[model samples]
Target: ATNPFTITKLDVNEKPRYSKEAFKTSTLQRDAYNYLGYSSTRTMMLAQYLYEGIDIKGETTGIITYMRTDVTRLSNEFVDAAMMHIQKNYGAQYLGKYQTTKDQNAQDAHEGIRPTNVLHTPEYVKANVDVSSIKDEKLFEDAMKLYARIYGRTLASLMAPAILEHTKVTFTSNHHDFNMKGVRLLFDGFLKVYEESKNKDVLLPKFHQGDTITMDAIVSIEKQTQPKPRYNEASMIKKLDELGIGRPSTYASIIKTLIERGYVTKEKNLQPTDQGILTSDELDKFFKDIINIDYTAEMESNLDKVSEGNYDKLSILKTFYEMFIPMIENAKVNMKKIQPVMLDETCPRCGSQLVIRKSKYGEFIACSGFPKCRYIKKEEAPTDS
Candidate 1:
């Protein structure tokens, strides 16, 4: 249904939009690894240190709530405290409504990540944690930054909706229709505390419905369709959450395992290594059932059921063993020994020829001279013409 129409009206609207649910959802979606392209496991470890009593000054006390959770449910006591803090600091108008809905798969035992005491702001923690002769100053700073993010998110979740004004202008040229949108923040509200939540505003000139304007220039740029992009650490973790492949508690570990096992390499995004591709092909040829995505997701579901006491854990293990043991035995005999691809270059450290070797870590260019020379370099991806 492609039809051209004249501009009927230039519309403008203003409304208040709540950010609590959005912040809660996005907090889970934003993985720590992807934020700085570092190890997610390290982020979790630091969060754990904050959660489990860190020595602040002389007394040891937890700085934040539990970090190993997918749930975004906040306890009433914490919510009330956060609301009161927001009202006291910002004003009465900034206090938001409390949220109650929880995800179906989310465990009810743990609360969403938040500061242990709203009164102890990130600034106070940073000042207290700072030591004169601190050996790991960077770690302490990073922990403080994370603490601030958690504090801001928690407080923002209990603040009022951000008010915005939106305007749309429609135009028609040669039976073709086009439109432009403009948005401006009318009130900061929760965004006053969570500065990261603000979107870039597009200011537009005032216009009437029937007003005509002359065009300065017209251009058409040539472009081609692009293939789907590869997944990054954050996107991959989000996908895992959607597919029920693993719990939030295990996401960091899963990523670490993939990197350690040489199954995936992180550059700007996660890319399968040469060894990884070969291993996958071999597994697909011999054990498609075991390596299947659906099967793995189903097993995760079964494990969850077992945890909930709906399924027998031993029975599930027995079923998996029955199917897997035979495959393992068969693969041991049939699987071919994969040889490394020898490269044209020589090792810089040693005079030996460089060979692309596959290890438990990943594929790398290593010196052929075994025990004597152990120099290695990361493999580079091929370039297009």
Candidate 2:
């Protein structure tokens, strides 16, 4: 029956949930992509400048700490300052309990990305920042926006969790039960600093148990399960973080390397090119056991252990060599070589046929007779990352 029904049971509960600790490298990149539409490379570049120091007035000021870090814990000094700021600017109740990182992948090398000084607000940075010696206007604006995000996130991390009152209503008819849920904001704690669209509350009309409530109608909505979407730069970083595939310092470079090599192209999402697919397929065929997520993640872990003095770097290198050296030799014997494309033009240097050869950079024209004629046609301008 598509009609109104009496509320059989109404339950409401008040709960408090904390926001995330702070912005780690992965989280910062993800948020920047989601909120500011900034690429990982772009975000990291701006963050580097901010960390290196910005010129405000006559003195140089470093607004943010190191950009590449996995840890979410702020320094004790920063936390103490933030707490004071929170208590003074925001109410005393806004002060939050300290949170610690549980991520096993996190290194203690650096604290999470945050403002070096809480008082240097976004507005201050916007008006005072100079990105270059000549002072780029656009760079100034982008830097300001990124700084604001970091500022808000850092303060929010040290604030108390938002309190919420959730109410659920259940109705039963003909053995079929329907449910309605509502949310009410009880306290804006961390939300005072960092705001998100999801933080909105859905206030419901007051209803008691066994009260008559109008359903309006029971309409059937057809929905199909959709396949998972491709990873954007942000989501890709997140997946890499989850798998522990790379370090904080390497995430930007990893994505940049993939894109630079023509392996992956960044459009709306990160799409693998033909070269990437073929490379992966060939590697999988010959080195599936070794060239995999598990191996990479394990190597990262070993590297971390080495950094922490828990494992020997030489032993790790020896173990890796034992496994990788044999694979290279086996591949050389069995794997098919990618033949270079022969170019119509001949090499003027050695009177040999020129061929198109690919490297980390784009394809370049080179002599096929490499041992005899080591001639390469240089491009108009060379570019290296």
Q: Which prediction has the highest lDDT against the true structure? A: 2
The segments of candidate 2 whose C-alpha lies over 4 angstroms from its true place after superposition are 1-10, 127-134, 169-182, 197-220, 308-311, 337-385
List TM-scores for all candidates, in order. Answer: 0.77, 0.81
Q: Per-residue alpha-carbon lDDT of model 2 for 27-131, expressed as tens digits?
A: 888888888999998999889878877787767888899999888888899899889989999889999987876587677788888899888889877666554
The 10-residue segment with the lowest total lDDT in model 1: 22-31
Q: Each model's number of backbone clashes?
A: 0, 0
**What C-alpha lDDT values do all the predictions have?**
0.74, 0.84
List the pairs of residues colliding in candidate 2.
none
**RMSD of candidate 1 to true structure, Å:** 7.0
lDDT of 1 by residue, 1-385 (tens): 1333455458889988676542232254363444433456767777876787656686777988878776777788878888888888899988888775676656556787888888889877767763753457787777766676777777877888898788887777676767779876778888887655334568666667877656555455689999988987777877777776777678878887888888888888889987678888999988999787798888877887888899999999899999999999999999865677888998898788888876675457788887799897765799998
Judge candidate 1 at residue 13 and give its lDDT: 93
